[model samples]
Target: MAALMLQGTGSDVGKSVLVAGLCRAFANRGLSVRPFKPQNMSNNAAVTADGGEIGRAQATQAIACRVEPSVDMNPVLLKPQGDRTSQLIVRGRVRGTLAAARWREGRAGLLVDVLDSFERLSAGCDLVVVEGAGSPAEINLRDGDIANMGFARAADIPVILVGDIDRGGVIASLVGTRAVIDPADAAMIHGFLINKFRGDPALFDDGYRAIEARSGWRGYGVVPWLADAGRLPSEDAVILERSAMSTGRRVTIACPITPRIANFDDLDPLRLEPGVSLLMIPPGTAIPDVDMIILAGSKATIPDLAFVRAEGWDIDIRAHHRRGKPVLGLCGGYQMLGRSIADPHGIEGPAGTVEGLGLLDIDTILTATKTLERVEGIAGGARFAGYEMHMGETHGAGLAQPVGHRADGSPEGAISADGLVAGSYVHGLLALAEQRAVWLARIGVDAVGPDHGASIDAALDAIAATLERHLDLDAMLALAQRAGHAATNG
Candidate 1:
């Protein structure tokens, strides 16, 4: 099977976005393509079509490939549980928690599972585009590493390094990587790609050639900052860039960013609304003036819950609700909006109960079983498609008035008696055109913006067009599959 892998000089060097763009670019050429990541560490996750969970980036890549996401796409997933320990997910199921120190000692065996998943995804595909985690330059983590060079060596996949030029010193980052890594590992990388370039490319021509001269690697053209990249959902990092809600918008919405926030991409559609001005309130800040406030999902709910109270956001939310402005929560945030949250089994953390924001007349209990599914529902009288990913069950007076119904006609979410407060386990409710319009209308906006899904498709196509125009697609494709380097041991 033919495959190519993109390994970064460092994290956030646009490796995930580049792999996603190439996946779409190749798929658009009528070639069957699949996206793979051996390991991913992020609280942002996507529930697979088969009722499993993987990194959100893989799911975005799956959308680019026009296929349903599967656990095979991301073999080992790591969800940070606040402390040094992480909850390990293998092939979509929880494998229990592992501390940073203990996980390193046992990860070599996990490579077998990683490769098995890659083998399955590689079957019957024209090409498989793989993404490496963090950077392979850290020789300290090289022994049992299944994320970067080790995975490439195990799978015999060709590697192309990527570096962010916008961050400056692209030449050093690329050349420095070659200088530090083992000779065998360095030999595996055939070329390098410079990403996030802005202004004149000719200004860096000497630096570009210098990278090739020092590293003995070919240059794969520079990629300017993608203009349409904002339309796509970011996978790993939380959106920290905050500004005032744009003036003259009919509705004002505030979404507070928690310390361990997860799946905040659910708010992407709202940012696209012309009549909606969305503000991302940072931690340790009071909720600002707005017609609506949405509490986003959190990886560590109890701790984040305590954090919210410590920041006095609980008072801010209650004040917002008292003014008759709406308050909404998703997943973990949904658990925090109820009367109380009980972790009797200590599924998330210590076994105890915490007082909630008390917006909804409901109580929740954390359990070991997690619900993962993609379903359609009705919200504010509009049919919508969304997904459920949570591990809590709620029961109280709020259940008497559900916010919507599932595709299978089961009730979901809850709406307050005064219609000013609600909480739901469903995510991506505003992504669809109808639901977005319904939400806008509820907040007194008369109009809705363009279709979110179409906008994303257009953005993906624009990225592919950029690749076909600026990058050497054929040469990169060859580099992806070509591998002929003698290596020394790490």
Candidate 2:
């Protein structure tokens, strides 16, 4: 099989985006190309056509490759829950939960499943560009690591290391990684690409020469940071970047940063609204005086609550509530708006009870059983489909009710007594344009949220166009084919 792997110097070094770009670039050259990640750790996941959940980055790459996203693309996914434990997903389905130590010991066998899927995809595609996870030189994790050099070595794939210059230490990161990686893993790397560079490329001439000499690798090129990357919906929640909301009658929802945030993409639909803004406020940033405040989804409710307290955002939220402005929360965010959140089992943090923002007069108890479901319902006279994945049961007085019903007409979630403040287990309800317009109209704005699926498709198309502008994708595919041929001969 013809396969090429993109390894990184470190995590968040723009490897995911580059793989997506390369997938698009290769597909544009009339070659069937697929994107693969042997393993992924992300809370931001997308529901596939097969009713499975996988990392959003692979889904985005699937879109770029103009192929249907499947479980095979991301064979193993790790969603961090709390403590040292993570929810393990195999082939886009929840396998079970595992602590870090146990997971590391068990991961080698899981790679067999990953390679089976990769082989299936390779059989059909002309080329497959696999994206590696984290840094290859994570020594402690290397033995069982299936996402980096291990996967590449197993598949006998040639690797291209990507370094993020914008993060600083581009030289050290590249040199250090090459120096520390196992001989076999290091040998797999055929070249290096410098990414996210700003200012003149000419200025980095000396640095590029230095990196090539020290690392003994070919310098493919130095790519400038693409400012228009905001046009795409990011799959990683931690890299949230604030953009200006379009001027008009807009309701800006301020999301206070939480440590273990999940599904932050819940607000992405609002981003498409011409007159609606979704502002993510990090700690220490003053809550902008805005139309509404939205507490976003979180994985660790109690610890995030503590973070809210530490940042003094608790006071800002209370003040917003007193002003009678509408406030909304989803899942863990919902738990935080309640009067109290109990975690006796310490599923999220130190065993204790904590007071919530108290905006909803509700009480929440973190439980061992997690609810994971996808369904459609009416919200404020609009139809929408969303999913609920959480480990908490919420109950309270003056709680709002869900707008619609399931097949049995059972109440699924809650809303406020005044119908202004609300909370729900559902994520992605706002992605429905009609529902978003109804909410915006209440805030005195005649805005219509764009169709989210269409926006994603457009973004993918745009990504393909951008990558086509740069990169010698045809040559890359030729290189992969040649490498595969060489491996077969050896």
Give the count of colliding residue pairs in each prediction. 1, 4
Model 1 agreement with the true structure over 206-286: per-residue lDDT tens digits: 998999899999998999888788788876654455356688877788988777888888888887888888888886678
Q: Extract clashing residue pairs from model 2.
A: 400-414, 400-415, 400-416, 401-415
Q: Candidates' lDDT values, in order?
A: 0.86, 0.80
Per-residue C-alpha lDDT of model 2 across residues 1-490, encoded as one tens digit per residue: 6889999988988888888878877787788989999999988877777767778889878887899888899999999866778889898787888999899899999989998989888888888999998888788889977998888888889998999999899999999999998888889998888889888888999999999999998877776786545556576765675444455634677787676788888888877777766677876787877888888888778888888899888888878777778778888888887789998887775788888877676899998876766767776677778777788888866444654554455665666666667777787778777777766766788755477766766665666665565455555677799987887698
Model 1 CA deviation exceeding 4 Å by range: 241-248, 483-490
Pairs with steric clashes in candidate 1: 184-487
User: Using alpha carbons, what is the TM-score of model 2?
Assistant: 0.85
Per-residue lDDT of 268 in model 1: 84
Root-mean-square deviation per candidate: 2.6, 3.6
Candidate 2: minimum summed lDDT over ten consecutive residues — where? 241-250
Question: Which residue runs of candidate 2 sit more than 4 Å off their true CA positions?
Answer: 101-106, 199-214, 241-251, 274-277, 284-288, 306-315, 338-370, 392-400, 405-412, 485-490
